[model samples]
Target chain A: MSVVRRSRWSYLSLQQAPLLLAFVMLGITVAAYVLFFDLRLHHLPTAFAWDSTISNALPLVFVAAGQGIVVLTRSLDLSVGGIMDLTNSLAATHMHSSVPSMLLWSLIVLAVGGATGLVNGLLVTVGRLQPIVVTIATMSILQGLAAWVLPQPGGNIPASYTNILANSNSPLGLVFIGVVAVFWLLLRRFRLGIALYAVGNDAEAANALGINVRRIRTSAFVLSGIMSAAAGLFLAAGSSGGDATGGDSYLLASFAAVVLGGVSFFGGRGSVIGVVCGAGVVTLLVSVLFYANVNSFYESFYQGIFLIGAVLLGMVVTSLAQRRARGSLRRSRRRW
Target chain B: MRNSLRGPRSSVLAIRLAVSALVGVLMTAGTIATASASSLAAGKDAHFTIALSNSYIGNTWRIEMENEFKSACKMAPIKTAVNCSIYNANNNVPAQRSQMSDLIASGVNAIVTDAASPTGLNSVVQEACARGILVVSFDNTVTAPCALKVNEDQYQMGYLWAKWLAQKLHGHGNVLMVTGVSGTYVNEQRDAGAQAVWKKYPGIHVVDQLNGQWDSEVAQRVVSAALPSLPKIQGIWCQGGTNGVLKAFQQAGRPLPFTAGEAENGFRQLMASGKVQGYSIGQAPYLSVVALGLAYEILSKHLSAAHFKTYNLPLAPVAVQNSNNVKGKTWFPSLGGDFFADVAQTGTGSTVAGLCLASAKSGTACPSGKLVFSFH
Candidate 1:
């Protein structure tokens, strides 16, 4: 009876790892905010501070959410940054003052994003190309196209549109986040989502179980592309302009967010909610450092160290839990 | 498998080699055009070939500077007397150094550069000067004594602005300072200048400071974020992105304070409309043309090298005519919000520096004459 109980406890811990990591990240974000507030009473953020923080994290959050799905299927989308640049350029160049024009251009941006993803999916699935090579090649092509479309960063984005997207009181930003969350929940209920996990765990076994591994992988890339485009729109809205090279920094940050959120780089782990929290943690770290009056030159260095620490801590916890479980299993076997 | 890959790899290598060879040949041909165009200084009928090597073309200011230089190249006596080539590197110091080296190799009579580094390109500048090539470094200049320098006193630009803000606030108020990109020499010097002036006035309290990155968007975002955490501000001292700083105040529903900012169109517009009380100053885009004119004068032996080894161009305080109308001669009512409005062709005569806003924008050749340099 004791052996069975011990095994159950270990199984529960294994299942709870990602969720536990997310809670820890959320705790860190709160502590950072409190420290930032304590630096000066006047520095205390307003009631809507959370809203603004969410808005700031929206771009990375969206990308990480999609990346979480892709990682679960054991694939990576390196082309997300390129897609973002292309989308940002399109929005800045075409989205004008009129409401109808803005709506029209936004749809066109989404379609372009989806089309780029479709191409990436087809290359990976149908062409049997390595995902990294195919995505990198596509990223280069998209970057060149972005540069061709808008050579410089100047474009006229209407103030009204920017205000709506950037305003803390506005529900528009929340709506975008909510849509992503709801989509992830609905995806969890679908057969494709289950197939993603199964294929990631063991592709041959999943194939033998009648799962279309190729289709699942292709769908993951498509979703990631769409998410990156949406993030690009958010960035365009925030900056009220276009920069072809601005999205370059997000490429690495997204990977860091994914790993920090407890998504295994190897495959078959993590959740969308955890990824969002991971993005929040990364953004909050920067804000905390900024408010703490750290030199801007050293900010990037501290961010790098924090990311490494989070990843290493996650690895340590996982290995320790696994070792304990293995020891318990041996003792149980000996007693039997 | 290795043999199969080798077939495509070798073909790719061959294609790359062919492409590089074609590029090399075209570059040589282009350089030859400039080299052969240089006329003897003895003959008024001959034209001098000059090349402008700019390190970064990522900002509006650089674009405007390039346009001004191009227009000046096409303008009058210079147009008939000078041929100009422009090369831009994307903010890489090594790349710019190599580009300058290539310009030196092209055998141009003069090379004008807006350097990427103050010291990184000193060796290249020295080499160019040693080759009898007139090298003039403008904007972010080099430290090489051989290269002629053309720039505004950046420290004074900051000092004057801070002095103005201190007086406007009666030397007693909480001020928020918005700075440019950190670790940049310009940003550091400007901060030091401001601090020097502020230290003189014990009442003038700087409540907070933040990096605005010399970018309007970044300035707006950071200022907006910092607003909720600060006390009431009576003054703002911004190195750049003044317009964005003002926009942040507006968004936060605060009254406009006494502001000293760089010359941006939106900031000038606000000042002209009486929405904000401030002074605007800028390192003019026309400085490039000024530098080029200096280079030409030196090359033609019209000016003494000793007189212009180190030149400080006058920093003009952008004048605002308090008219609600944007039709003031100094500010444009029709141009985009990002256009630098203080652009004027300054020299001895109308014929020599006859640069207009249209010519600067369109790169059309305007009439040129001899440019008199005010050496200090």
Candidate 2:
């Protein structure tokens, strides 16, 4: 009886593993931010505002959230950078002074983003192409398109649009984050989401169980495309201009966030919330380095070390849990 | 399992196929663009055909440089005597090399380039020279012996700013040194120049050196982050984004320091408003025009390429005291914030009257000016 009880508790903990990891990452990010701020300022910054932090982390969060979904389905989207660049270029070039035009341009950008995603999905699933290859091709095409649209970085984006998207006090960024999180939660309740998890965990088993593995994989890419487009919009809004190469930096960061969020690279695990927190950690890490007054030359080095450490920590926690669960199963079997 | 081996193999094959296809498409596109551009120059018998091969247009500075070239090409003498075409490589050194080769094949008389690297384009530049095409390299230049170089002393731009900052601070103060992108040649040279000056002034302490990436928004964030840790900075030696550095100080409610940086319009505006005391020593965007003029001179056989090898153009450091007076002349008050305030032709024998904001932006026709170089 005791063995069964202990096994049940272990199973429950295992089920909550992703959530626990996410909280731990969030805690670390906040602690690091405070510690760095104190170390730099020689005192705790009074009345720390979440507004700037939210705005800063929002772009990466959007990308990582989509990336987490794709990773969950055992695929990768290298085209996020291209999608972001395209959206940024388009918005900067077309989203001019008028509020109505801004809205139209925004929709157009998002649609383009979704279309790019659709192409990636189709190539990977229908065309029987590799995800990496498809996304990379699409990324190149999108980057070229972006360069063609805006050869240079100078474009007049409407201040009103920038004000709405980038404003710290506006709550638009937070609301957007909330909406994406809620959407993921809603998705989890759907058949497609469960199918995605099943497909990622074991495609052969999922196929045997009558799930369309191809559709799940395609849907994940499509979702990733849409999310990347959203990230591009926020990035353009925040920067208040178009930069063809701005999105390139987010590519590695998105993958790193997914891993740090405790999302298994092999897929079928991790939550959207965890991914969002993981992005928060990555973004906060940059802020910490800046605040710490670390030499600019060593910034990349420090970031690399922190990222590797986070991934290692996640791996160790996962293996320990697996080992404990396996031991418990053995003990329970013996008792039986 | 059979599935595992096939999966990796097929993926590798797909990647290879996709990359080759993309390369093929890009090559075709490049050929077509080059063909059309060169054809425009083919029709003019009397005009000296010149092409500007710019390696990057990722920043406002490059845009300004290109615009200056366009405006200069439209000017009276060049308008009738030369057919100029601009080709940008989007920061790819290989693409630039290929572009230069195409230009050489197109039979252009001269090729002016703002090279992506000092040594990356040496072979192509040598190839162009061997094909009897005059190549003028500027800004980020090539090290090819055959090419004529037109550049301001970048080292002096940093040295003068540091010297001015040191003088303003009375040789003793805490200073925050905001630099440009890390690992870049320009950044390294600027840092070296500043360090050379700052080392002499042992009293002036450099509290921090942050990389601003030569961008306004980035500089603002970096300076803001470093501000709290800093102890009452009396001077700021910034390589670029002076406006952003000032904005950060304003945001923090700190008194503006004796700042020195590039000739960004916003920085000049701040100087005019007496919000910041500083100097705007610009790496002039009109250096492109100087380079184009050199190409024109060489192509026309007015200047011998052998005699006029490395031409170091003079540097003009604009002080804050002159900011208000030089608004319409040296700087544009009505232009966008990112506009490089110092857009004048720095070389001798070139009149400043023709190089205005309107001509630079819209490529309006201007009176002809002679291409004269003051050699190093």
Candidate 1 per-residue lDDT over residues B90-138, each given as its tens digit: 5644345445654554467898889765544554566577778888888
| lDDT tens per residue, model 1, A1-336 | 999799778766765576587668678667756655455335456544455555667778887887788888888989888888888778878898999998888788888888888899889989999989999999999998887776645354565666665444444667777787788878878998788888778888999999988888888888888888887777676556665654655777788788778888777766777787788776665545434434223445555665665666566556545655766776688889
Q: Estimate each model's TM-score.
A: 0.49, 0.50
Q: What does candidate 2's lDDT look like per residue over A156-184, in tens digits?
A: 56768766776544456788888888998
The ten-residue window of minimal lDDT in model 1 chain A covers: A290-299
- The whole-model lDDT of each prediction reads 0.72, 0.74
Candidate 2: the clashing residue pairs are: none
Show where candidate 1 strays beyond 4 Å. Answer: A1-336, B1-45, B316-328, B345-353, B366-376
- lDDT of prediction 1: 0.72
Q: Candidate 1 versus the native: TM-score?
A: 0.49
Model 2, stretches more than 4 Å misplaced?
A1-336, B1-45, B316-325, B346-353, B367-376
Residue-wise C-alpha lDDT for candidate 2, range B2-43, written one tens digit per residue? 644554466566546644653554354334433443222223
